[model samples]
Target: MVTNEQSVAGPAAEQQGFLHQVKSFGRPFWAANVMELIERWAYYGVRAVLSLYIVDAVANGGLEFTHVQKGSIYAAWAMVQSLLPLFTGGYADRYGYKGTVAFSILIKIVGYLLMATQHSYGGFFLGCMLLATGTAVFKPGVQGIIANANLGNKASVAWGIFYAMVNVGGFIGPWAAGYLRMMSWAHVFYANAALVALNFIILLMFKEPERPAFEGKRPSPVTEFVGILFSSVKNVFEPRLAAFLVLFSGYWLMFNQLFDLLPNFIDDWVDTSGTLAWLGKTLGNPTMLQNGLAGGQIQPEWMINIDAGAIVFLMVPIAALFSRMKPIHSIILGILVSTIGIVLSGSTMVGAYCMLGIFIFAIGEMMASPKKLEYLAAIAPKDKMGLYMGYANVPNAIGWGIGSSLGGHMYQTYADKTTLAKAYMADKLHMTPEAIAAIPKNQVMETLAAQLGQTPRQVTEMLFAMHHPEHIWLVFGAIGIASMVGLIAYNAVVTRLPKPATV
Candidate 1:
């Protein structure tokens, strides 16, 4: 049996410089990183604009689904994407990473095409499920490759570099999507499909990492699947790991909002004309000043892109800084910082402040996200690295599914401008529900503005003043604080427990 020290690193590696250690990770590692980059690019490209596409008025090229419907789709998406990995990870280990990856690529391609062609709610939901499933399968295969390739003590550095590559795609995908969607939303989906296909070529460039052989005759597929499911459940329920995952779910609940809810929030309330005008003047580019909105507002994707952009440039150093610290400590610190960022981002309509908050949140993300994977990888048994890594997604699944459902309800109740507008017409104008129903849902705000003898921006400001929509951030931020506190307590308890005996 290979010792933990040997599995992690050779003594000779300790003598090498950091750059040399990085280079030593070799071809398979780099190839996996590239594949990760491409995959993230494809996923985020669609994701960056999905909320808008789902909830925007049909006249404006969106599906015009209610916030509640959008939430249901996202909640289901989280379940399929995050939970399926629990089993797929074992499959990758038992079969081969290469075959799983190839299968996922095809699944993802079909998903993108469905999204592009099918605009109905049921059709689009199916598309998203397919995409999520493909992503679920894809994650463990690539992560397993990384686990096998990083045969050194610089695991933190290796994961950080991999994360930075993830942001490279994250940053670029949204930037491109911001422009592509201007032409047409269909263009964005098609573009992502093409980008995902590039991974097929990347798959050919790397050899599969060696996997452990089964000692006995392999079980039938049905038996093996059941065994994997039972084993995964048992492993997750181990008290220490279970406590950590449950606490970590709160962080993910808050983390996912930056993507799932914030885009709609920005679109409905935040005014970005000032930022757009500033950029256009600063860059001497006229195109930056126009977005078909009344005041030439900055696109929501560009605003949210701040999070990915900050990580792309800063993740490595931040990871290195926290490399020697206990993973739990880093995570606690990150959650605290992130809570502040979330509240700040959501508390106002000022575009610059929103961007600043996103940037701060990115710092917290840099500190926390990679460490979660590193911590899980460290504790996993040598032979079950892929299975354990699959387990790493559990927190995200729980958090995202719950958060999406709750956040959708929250937005619908407390913050939806159209809903508020309809209410305003009912209470203030003494308009009946039937009268309000006569107006197009997309044009409710415009109609409200006309009735009040105000511009759309003026009506939006009035609604903000009367309704206080920004309070939603406080609610989500509180979840992060609770998570941070839970993690701290869990860490204390774990630290007091006895360490396992080294063989």
Candidate 2:
């Protein structure tokens, strides 16, 4: 029978009427949102700088990793960030959410501390793993506390607020890092350290319902993780949840690009430095000029501008608009609209096109992104909220890892690597790399070819002009359509699965 503890009236209950005792909001809700903001700030701040740090050359204080090496590390980081939660959530249940989150903050402190000093691959990767570990531990537990504390009618609004806070944190984290890194690269990591440190202190004042029976024991994350790995993996596939997870991966693949590839793309293609220079000249303060790189020529922090700016402009209004639709349809509509935007961002050689793409994509993302997890929460079994919510990251990880690998493959193939790069350049100028390479370093290939054996500059121009960038555009479009179609079919089946009676 439900005890007095379950039924007793509280402020949470006061908000609801006689028929419903569910919470609408409480002190715990505010505490949870505050903690979430700090966690996301720390996570995204560090993340925004990591890839750039890895790929930087000696001149730039970086390791100058091959694209493949960088991609592999990025993919691994994404995998760990997503997969680690499976065990960490259980460990938090057994230990205590507060303690677990505190421990996570400590881990992050150590991770960022190591990163600020260690500029090599070993040090960088160790830091990345630790960072992912901390993120994994904190995420589900934070949400878990929010869910448990606001168990009644307030849970929905409580979660919505939590998610909005997450985006707010995400928005601020990268922007702060970008601005700080422009001041000094060390400042980026220092800022992250400061944000995470705040979490450690803030959590001390936060209280939760109860720890599990094993709460006193400090569980080893590794051991606890391994023990539950199979169980959690098996849990999601038990007939009802499999289809959803499968389709959800596609959305993740799209969303992951924001974190994984967009910055780098901006680094190569954007003229932010030029724009900043122009602004500086116009303003008569050259020192005020900035690059697309936080510290250099490109200002990648502005890439976060798309996500932050877009969310601010689009999220609430879209949520209000979509208030009547099924979450699945919202996700579908979002995926389609965002995919078109993503393709437009990458397809055109122009930076303005990509910026517009991010803006449009942001609108789509605001519409769908929140509902993804909200839908999962609604459909999950009552007893397994921690397990399912923890698994919400599965899509994020899936998208990031796959997108990184895909971006690397594309970059290596077309932009930075051998065949596609050469072909793509050739498409621009009616010449192969061999032809370009054969010409003297300073000489224009077409102009020099006219000096050597080529018939005319116009022939090279004809050959180059015929190469189809449009085919490349189609490649991205197909991926988007394929994902949408898959989700449509998968959801067609998943909607029939057994869900909780109340949600």
Which is the leading candidate under lDDT? 1
Task: Give the alpha carbon lDDT tens digit for every residue of 243-318 in model 1.
Answer: 8889999999999999999999999999888887778778777777554233878888889888887776776578
| Candidate 1 segments whose C-alpha is farther than 4 A from its true place | 1-31, 145-161, 204-210, 286-294, 377-388, 500-503
Worst 10 residues of 1 by lDDT: 1-10
- Residue 448 of model 1 has an lDDT of 96
- Give per-model TM-scores: 0.90, 0.76
lDDT of 2 at 237: 81
Query: lDDT for every model?
Result: 0.83, 0.65
The positional error of residue 335 in candidate 2, measured at the CA in angstroms, is 1.0
Q: Best TM-score goes to which candidate?
A: 1
RMSD of 1: 4.4
lDDT minimum window of 10 residues, candidate 2 = 1-10
